[model samples]
Target: MAQVANLFDIIHLNKKLADKHIAAEVHLRDACGRQTLWFELKDVEEDTLSRAQDVAISYFAGKGKPIEFDIAKGINFWIKQF
Candidate 1:
């Protein structure tokens, strides 16, 4: 009965890129209304959406919570648990 957390609300791309790297930012908000920002980089042979997805998977998986993209309406975009 573990609680499921929303990944999208926590991590998002900043739409900025440099060379073969893409920028991703993490935003965390606690019940106390405190927030924090963390910047991350993803290196790829070539910048593409597919590579971005791969980077995201690796990032979250490292956190012990793997997720997959869901395109269905009302469903969380990142919705797999591991």
Candidate 2:
């Protein structure tokens, strides 16, 4: 798992997840006076998405807030300034 240093890497990961039938959403934001990024998975089974989420979480964990994911729904991610 390489560090996501730019938008391209983010987009690439999203496509990869989608290719695997996983719905992933990536959001970028600068809010709350802090800079942070997060990834969420929705509209998927917990079992199917868990592995992906684990990898993602491991990559971005502790960067800010804990990553939030809902496999039963869809996948979404966001960045915030807090």
Q: Which candidate comes out best when scored by lDDT?
A: 2
Quote model 1's TM-score: 0.40
- Candidate 1: deviation at residue 8, Å? 12
- Estimate, for each residue in 28-81, the C-alpha lDDT of model 2 and write its tens digit: 554554433445657656575565665556545554434555445434443322
Once superposed on the true structure, which residue ranges of model 1 sit more than 4 Å away at CA? 1-20, 23-47, 71-76, 79-82
lDDT of 1 at 34: 23
The C-alpha TM-scores of every prediction are 0.40, 0.44
Candidate 1 lDDT (Cα, 0 to 1): 0.42
lDDT of 1 by residue, 24-53 (tens): 333333343322223332343344445555
- The worst-scoring run of ten residues by lDDT in candidate 2 lies at 73-82
Please state the error at residue 76 of candidate 2 in Å: 10
